[model samples]
Every structure is written in C-alpha cells, then in structure tokens.
Target chain A: MGDQLIFTYIVDGDDFTRAGEASSSVKNKLKMLGVDSDVIRKVAIAMYEGEINMVIHADGGTITVSVSDDDITMVLSDSGPGIPDIEKAMQEGYSTAKEEVRSLGFGAGMGLPNMKRFTDEMNIDTVIGQGTTITMKVYL
Target chain B: MTIGEIQRVLDAQFLYGEELSDLDADFVFSADMMSDVLAYGEKCSILMTGLCNSQVVRTAEMLDIVCIIFVRGKMPDANMLSLAMSKGIAILATKHFMFTACGILYEHGLRGGA
Candidate 1:
C-alpha cells in the first residue's frame, strides 16, 4: 500500500431510504480523482452492497475507506448481530433477511457474494452477539 | 435503439433528463429486485424497474447505467428524481407494466443485457 487517503462515513440504521449515500459519495470522489472506470465500478458495487447490509441486517455501522496507489480498501464495522456461519452466509441465495427486506429489493442473498465478486480481497470478523466487520479491497 | 425511440414506442413521459433523451443504448435490463440487477445485470445502459426508491438510482449509478424507466405507472418521488438527475441518469415513466414495457422494446429490436 502506498500513501493512503482515508474517508469515513456513518451508515444510519434508522433509515432504509438513505442506505447508499456513502457509496455514492465514494463513487463521486473516485470519479473526481480520475480513477479508471472499471476500478470505480467495482468499488462502488462492493461498497454499496456492504452499506445496504449494514442497514438491513445491522442497526447501523461505520465505514472507513482508504485510497492508495495500488488499491482501495474499505472497512465496514457494524454493532448488530454477527453471523453465526460465515460459510453459510457466503453461499449465494442463502439469506436470512426478512420478508420486508426482500420486498425492498434486497436480502436476495446476493449481497455478500456480489461484494466478493467485485473485490480482490475480503475478510469477515463476526461474533454472534457482538457485531460484524467486513473488509474489502479493490485493486487499482 | 435510442432512449427517445423507446420513449415514443412506450408513450412514456420523461420525469427528468430530457436532454439525455437522444442517447442510445444497446441493451436493456428489467427487474424489481435490485439484488438480481446487481448480480445479473451487466453492460446494460438502460434499467427498467417497478421498484421505486433511492437505491434504484444508486444501483444504476454503480452499474454505469445511463437511463432508468419506471414501469407499471410507477413514478419516483421528488427526492428520487433529484438524485437520479444529479447522477446524470435519465428518468422515464410508462404506464405499461414491467413485462409490457420490456416486450415493446424487445419487439423494436432492443436486446436483453443478459
């Protein structure tokens, strides 16, 4: 990693309507920075999914994004209930999201898989009762 | 086909981005589920959905989609419209349901994104 430019955002759990604000902000910043479209696309998609997950599954969380010469690193930390089975959660179409969430056009169990698909690296740290933190990186 | 052509074929109304009406797109993706859109929608320039929300515009932004058509007479509120406009995504609304709108476009030779 080269010199890093870090951006932090708070994902509000109370409002489902504002979930993607952070991702949108990051996308605009990356665009202004003249990053490649493909890299920006990947980061935007991965981070947006993480933001939605925070609002839907967790109460809310904080995200830290670091922009470097070689890659962009995103760390999403939430204080909501943690995943009991990371393995199961990784499976596509295996979602624990409620019916209401599905109606909102999410909770299709594609969030995690899509995040992994768009990022070069991903790691999840979770404790059942404590919370979850997901780290994802997209290489430039 | 051009977005303007699609608008004419469907008799749709432009809620925003009339300036972008002439833009052309090779592919179209229609769905109410944003998750499906994220997973299966690729290389689509126009997104047609009945699900109206801020996330819909956000999803289009992430995918680099240039246009959005709200189907089944669904009209996005002011907030959604403003967000879409700011992101430079043209917004269109049609009375035709999701299936009908997509079918009309397909009949006119617009292909699915797949």
Candidate 2:
C-alpha cells in the first residue's frame, strides 16, 4: 500500500450473530494488501472486541479503518449509554453486561483491555449519555 | 490431534465439519471467554468452549483456530453451526464437562500452545 487504505463499516446492533463482520472484513483486506499476519491479527482482535462492545453497549455504530505502510488505524464510534467511569471500564474483569450477554460469551470486561493490548496506541472519548469513540493504531 | 481424534477421545458428536475434524493440530486452547482466547497468542490450532454463540465461531475465524469443541454436551445454534461450517471449522460436542474433556485430550498427547 502507498499512504493508507481506508475502510468504513456500519456495525449492526440488532443481530449479535453478525457483529464481527466489519472486523473480519478489515482483516481480510489487510491480508490481501500483504500486511503482516501478526499485524492482521492485532487489528482483527482489537477491532473485533470493539465491534462486540458496540453491539452490546452502544446499540451498534460505525468503524473506520485506515491502513498505511507504517500502521493501521481504527476509529469506532457508538451512540449508547456512554461509559460512566472510563477508569473502571479500563480495569480488566469489570463488566456491566447483562446476564444474557455473559451467556453469549462476552462481558468479561476485557474489551477495552484487549483493544489496548493489541494496539500500539489507543484513545477513548465518551459522554455519559451520548456516545463513545475509540481510536486505535497498530504499527506494521 | 485431528478433529477426528478429539471426537474419539471425548466420544463427541459431530454437529458439523466432519470433513475438517480429521486435520491434525499441534495444540489446543480451551476457554469459554473469547477474550482469554484472543489474549492467548496465535499458537493453538483447536479451541474448546462451552459458550455457544456466533461470536465463538467468529473468534475462531479471527484467530485461525481450525476446530472448536463444545463441551458439556452443549450444542450450537443453527446460525452458529452454519458460521463454523462456512469457515471450515469443525464443531464437536462431548458429554464430558470442560475439564474432563480437556484432561482426556491432554492425557492423550495434545498440548497447549507454545
């Protein structure tokens, strides 16, 4: 790739089954662009976690990905009950997910942490009742 | 171990992915939570989970996990099975609990990821 490859997706909140489509698509695109396998994995995991978070907490949102020679950047924005405590949410294993969500195999409070773990840089912007936006970058 | 051998070990029922179950895998990672599995680097080729959801299949797809074993006699929903099938991921369910199923596989020579 030259400067960067850009991708935009709308995550659907209604269907949990389809939540990972965006991240999967991004992963595929990165692979096709000849990005490193480890880089692709990081993008996939971080974005996949963000996608699920959008569906579970934010009722879906939009994800924008920009791929460049040096790095991959993902911007995820969701309109939901904004995070009340960013610090608490950042702590591993602190989850406010419903029982049904936990049953489906999520809500371990690892979403934000995984995002941070897999990315070179990450930033979160949120309002208590409005929405939240997460930006993450993975160096190639 | 191949998916076929795992089936034989747990005496699991193949819910989908019969063709893929026979593929040999060097390692196995067992977990119900996708986050834990993701945190586990890309070493394990097989995944064992009691959680039945599309996300489980999606997680496998993301991590390049070749097979998923649903323990405790749990079965996947139609959508989940279809998703796994589309990804060429073998799905097997055993009557044994999570720990027992893993123990049987480990005793037989299947090791965790490096």
Candidate 3:
C-alpha cells in the first residue's frame, strides 16, 4: 500500500436510508487493501455510528478516512447544531433524538459511547450553535 | 447450526440468500437499536431484529453478520433486500415476535456471544 491513502465522503442528512453508504464503501476499500478483518470491522462500526449521528443530529457532514501502515484515522465534521454537552452526550443512555429516530431503531443514546468503545482513540471538538468535529483512530 | 436448520426451527421465510442456507452460526444477537448491535454484535454471526430498514442490512454488512432474522413479521423493502443480496447476507422473516424467535433459536443451541 501507499504511505497514506485518504478518502472523503459527503453524507446527506435528508436521506435516512443512505446513512451508512460511506462507511460501507470504506470497509470494502480496506478489505481490498488487505487490512485485518478486525481492524476493518472496528473502523466500519465507528464510522457507521458517526455517519448515523451526522444524519440524525448534524443535518449532514463530511467524513475523511485516512489509511496508513500503522493506523486508520477518521474525521467526521458537520455544520449543524453542535453538541451542547459533550459529557452528557458521552453517557450511555443520554439522547436528544426524537421518537421518529427511535422508531427507525436508532437513537438509543449509544452512538458516541459505541464509537469510543470500538476505536482505539476518539476526540470530539464542538461549538454551541456552530458545528462539531469528531476524530477517531484504530491501530493496525 | 446451519441457517437452514435455523429457518426450520423458527419457521422463517427467506427473503434473500437462500443459497446460504448451509452457512453456520453459533451465536446470535437480538436487538432493535443498531447502535447496540454495533457495540456488542461483533462476536455474533446472526442478528435477529424487529427493525426493518436499509440501515439494518448496512449494520449487518459492517458486522459481517451472516444472516438477519426480522421478527414480528416485519419485512424489508426492495432496496434493503437488494443491498443484503449484494452483500451476501441472508434475510429471514418470521411471524414470531422477537422474544419467541430468540427463544426458539436459543433452544436450538444458538447461544449469544460474550
């Protein structure tokens, strides 16, 4: 593989049906690159959860995944209403999603915690009324 | 057990991947929330859920779940079916509710993953 390979995807918030497209694409790409299955699974799940969060709360976002020999890094950025309380949002069962989202089998307040649980490292940067950016990494 | 046996056990109808009936999975996870599935579903090869949507299939694909059993007679739309087909993930539908379907699978030796 190259020293570093990067891929970016634009997530459309209006379409709930298409939320995990980017993560799926990345997973296939990593598979073709011969990345470890466990690593690929971790990246896919973390990014998929981030993708769902972007759709449900951020209204839309851009996800950039970079693959290298040592680790894989994913950055999810959004320009919607930012997370007001990172601490609360990080809780396992604290959620601000509506009933509609719950009806779709999501919004159980597990997105951020699951993201953190799956990845080796996760960082969140947010500003109230502005936007949020989440960066995650998984070591190979 | 093989997916075929699981189908017979739960009286499920295959919506896709009927050819994969020979596939075997020892562990099964049941949940409606995709996040919970993502969090703890890695060790399980079969996912049983009441949620019917494209994201469910997408979640299965990410987790490499061999099959998804939609309980309570919930049906997945064409787009979801095609997506699951393309990913080589089997889809099953049963009239049994989540509790009963899971119980049947458990009784048949499909244990939950740690």
Candidate 4:
C-alpha cells in the first residue's frame, strides 16, 4: 500500500449543513483518480451516511479514507455515546436520533444498514461510554 | 424524461442547474428520508422529496441523482442551493404534493430505476 492515498477530515458536528463536505471531497478525488463511476458512487454513499451519523449522533468525528489499487477503506471514528446494542441499532427502523434529527430528513434508522449494504466489508467497534469506530472497505 | 419535461409536467421552478434542463433521467425515486434515498437511489434518477436541506442535495450527489424535485411547494434555502450548484445537480421546486408529482411522472412513463 505504499502508493495508497490517504485522506482524513474532521467532521464538524456543529454545522449539520456542512456534514457531507468530506464525502463530497472524496468522491471528487476518486473521480480525478479515474475510479469507476459505480465504485465511486458506493464509496460516496457509504461515507456520506457515516458522515451524517457522526454529525447527528456523535457531535463530530474523524473520517480517514485510503485509496489503493484494489480497494478503498474508510474508517469513521466518533466520540459520541457508543451504541448500546449493535444488533438493535443494525435493525432497519431502530434509531436513537432525536426528533430534531428526523425533521432534518434523516434518522430513519437506515444509516448503518445502508453503509453495510454499500461496502464490501464492514466492522463496528464500540464501548458503551467510550466511542465507536466503523471501518468499511469497498473493493475496486 | 428530461429534467425539462419533468419540470414542465409538474410546473416546477428551477432553483439551480437550469442549464441541465435537457438532461435525461433514467428513473425517479421519491422519499423524504435521506436514509431511504441512500439505500435505494439509482444512477441518473430524479429524486422527489419534500425535504429541503443540504442533505437532500448531498444524498442526490452521493447516489448520482441528476435532479431533485422538492415537492409540496418546499423551497430549498441558500445553503442547499449552493451545494446543488457546486455538484451540478438540477433542482426543481413543485407545488404539487409528493404523491401527485410521483403519480404524474409515473403516468407519463418515467418508471423507477432498474
């Protein structure tokens, strides 16, 4: 992975309006790198969902994306209250996001599921009070 | 249908990307929830939603949705318009409710994406 391109961004939780900037940036970079349109789309959607989740629930986070010849890896780490039950959270309609978040057109409980759906591999690591980190890889 | 045709059918107003009016959409997906859009939106699709936020534009950008129809007379704010402009995503605001807008498009033969 010596030639891998790693891009990291600090998601600002204070501005819900700016949540997707990082994901958008990555999509542009992938496009410039001549990644396949379909693969670029999957990475964009997955990372966008993760970015939104961090803004809504985690009050902010760090997203690190690395692009290599074979795949693109995204690590979303947040300091928000960790998910209580991974199984429950994985359910399609289960969400802890506030009503305010729902009013913003999200919190449909599909974030995690959609992320998992778009990526080739996904793993969630969390502790009740500590934080959560979701690592997802999309094969090119 | 082209974004121009859809706009004409719905009598919608263009908030951005008017230059892309001639662009054709392969299909349409209507939903207010960004999650559903992310999960199911397809390429070259037009999104119809009552949600008016930057996220709507962001979601459409992620899914490669070519146009966004803000149904129910919902108008996007400056933040959303700026984002859409940057992404080159067309924005149409229709006074028609979501159901009616979708109905009109479906009746006119704009099926959902494959």
Model 2 Cα lDDT, one tens digit per residue, B41-96: 47888999888888889999889888888988889889888888887888888999
- For each of the candidates, what fraction of the native contacts does it recover? 0.77, 0.68, 0.84, 0.89
At residue A95, candidate 1 shows an lDDT of 98
In candidate 4, what are the lDDT values of residues B12-110, reduced to their tens digit? 999898899999876888888889888887654788899888889999999888899999999998978988888899999999998888899999988
Per-residue lDDT of A1-140 in model 3, one digit per residue for the tens? Answer: 76899999999999999999999999999999999999999999999999999999999899999998889999999998999899999999899999999999889999999999999999999998889999999999
For model 2, how does the per-residue alpha-carbon lDDT over A72-125 read when each residue is reduced to its tens digit?
A: 999999989999999999999999999888888889888899999899999999
The candidate with the higher DockQ, 1 or 4, is 4
DockQ list for all candidates: 0.84, 0.77, 0.89, 0.91
TM-score values for chain B across all models: 0.97, 0.95, 0.98, 0.95
Deviation of model 2 at A25, angstroms: 1.2
Q: What value does the lDDT take at residue A39 in candidate 2? A: 87
Alpha-carbon shift of residue B51 in model 4 (angstroms): 0.6
**Model 4, span A1-140: residue lDDT tens:** 44999999999999998999999999999999989999999999999999999999999999999998899999999999999999999999899999999999899999999999999999999988888999999998
DockQ comparison, 2 vs 4, better candidate:
4
Cα shift from native, residue A36, model 3 (Å): 0.2
Candidate 2, pairs of clashing residues: B4-B21
C-alpha lDDT values of all predictions = 0.93, 0.89, 0.94, 0.91
Identify the superior model by lDDT, candidate 1 or candidate 2: 1
Candidate 2 or 4, higher lDDT?
Answer: 4
TM per candidate: 0.97, 0.94, 0.98, 0.97
- Model 2: lDDT equals 0.89
Poorly placed runs, candidate 3 (over 4 Å): none
